[model samples]
Target: MSPSKQGKSQLIDSLYQKAKKLHWKQCEQCRVKKNLFKFVR
Candidate 1:
């Protein structure tokens, strides 16, 4: 992949990882919303 594309993917991966961590910290309704966001993405 091109450098820019690779960089974006890396950023997204990191964000996803962060989101996963946040998932556990979030309340039940927010967790469900995040799950739906993940599915839609």
Candidate 2:
């Protein structure tokens, strides 16, 4: 991959990791409710 493209991919990976953490936290907080909302479509 090109330099710029490689950098973009790395950034995207970190963002995905962060988003995953947020998703888990939200699910835990909403466990009492029957319906769960999606963060990603």
List the pairs of residues colliding in candidate 2: none
In model 2, what lDDT does residue 20 have? 100
- Top of the candidates by lDDT: 1
What TM-score do all the candidates reach, one by one? Answer: 0.59, 0.70
- Identify the runs in model 1 with alpha carbons over 4 angstroms from their true place: 27-41
lDDT for each residue of candidate 2 in 1-41, tens digit (9 for 90 to 100): 89999999999999999999999998878873534444332
Q: Summarize candidate 1's per-residue lDDT along 1-41 as a digit string, tens digits.
A: 89999999999999999998887667777878999999999
Computed on alpha carbons, the lDDT of every model, listed in order, comes to: 0.91, 0.83
